[model samples]
Target: MDSFKHMHEWRQNIDRFFGESFWNEFDSILKPNIPQINIYRKDYEILCVINIPGIQQIKQIRCEIDGYHLRLQGEIELPAKGYELIQEEIIQGSFNRAIELPYRCREDKVHARYEHGLVFVKLYKDVHDSNKSKTISIEEGEQ
Candidate 1:
């Protein structure tokens, strides 16, 4: 029938408008999230496992803690040089990622290690005195 032929043509036109090349261009424009991380909470400490490949040295990564947040900054470099890139799926660039912790961590008790292209960070929780109270002094001020 003519109606079925027209429907097929419409579908083909729509598919040609948004084809594989369009999606490939879109993927190139949007960068994927690099250095994926996983966090685990234990009784007294938090463990963070981060995937950071293509790092040549441990000094390429830096970790910092602020309040209840952990910040990781690093650069990933490809081990091979002087080679043409035919296809690229792994991302290689400088990245900064921040992770929110469940509780405040002690700055002095934190430790991190890099092995087998993965960084393991251990953060010890800070003990707080919940029952401690402070007396407030009231002062009169102008309106």
Candidate 2:
């Protein structure tokens, strides 16, 4: 109860001090995690859909699967051979995005295919035994 009041007062003070403009300026420094993801879960497996447009080479992308999360890091390099630039708006550098997978995926069984500038990665996960839980018998001994 006391903690809630303190938290409320703290939030009100922060809101009064910074307002909206201060928050916008602070948001400009840190890029928000943005991605178009569609997830589907079936009885057998889960499907994850991602759209990574404006990418040149699929080989430049690095993907890693850890537990139930997928870590993706890559850079979209600017194209050198092309027409002269009139208005350059798109940024060129490095970017990384992570997605929490519904299930664990096998590393070697993962397959990736690129077509029409879209990458489709197929991951296979070995089903685990979901029927057991560790139970520790505790006995309190007087010290």
Task: Give the per-residue lDDT of model 1 (tens digit) for 15-89.
Answer: 698863655555436876667789999999999888888776666787777657788888878877889988987
The reply for model 2, stretches above 4 Å from the true place, is 1-35, 77-93, 129-143
Where is model 1 poorest over a 10-residue stretch in terms of lDDT? 134-143
Q: Flag clash pairs in model 2.
A: none
Q: How displaced is residue 5 in candidate 2, in Å?
A: 31
In model 2, which range of ten residues has the least summed lDDT? 134-143
lDDT of each: 0.73, 0.57
Number of the top TM-score candidate:
1
Deviation (Å) of 128 in candidate 2: 3.9
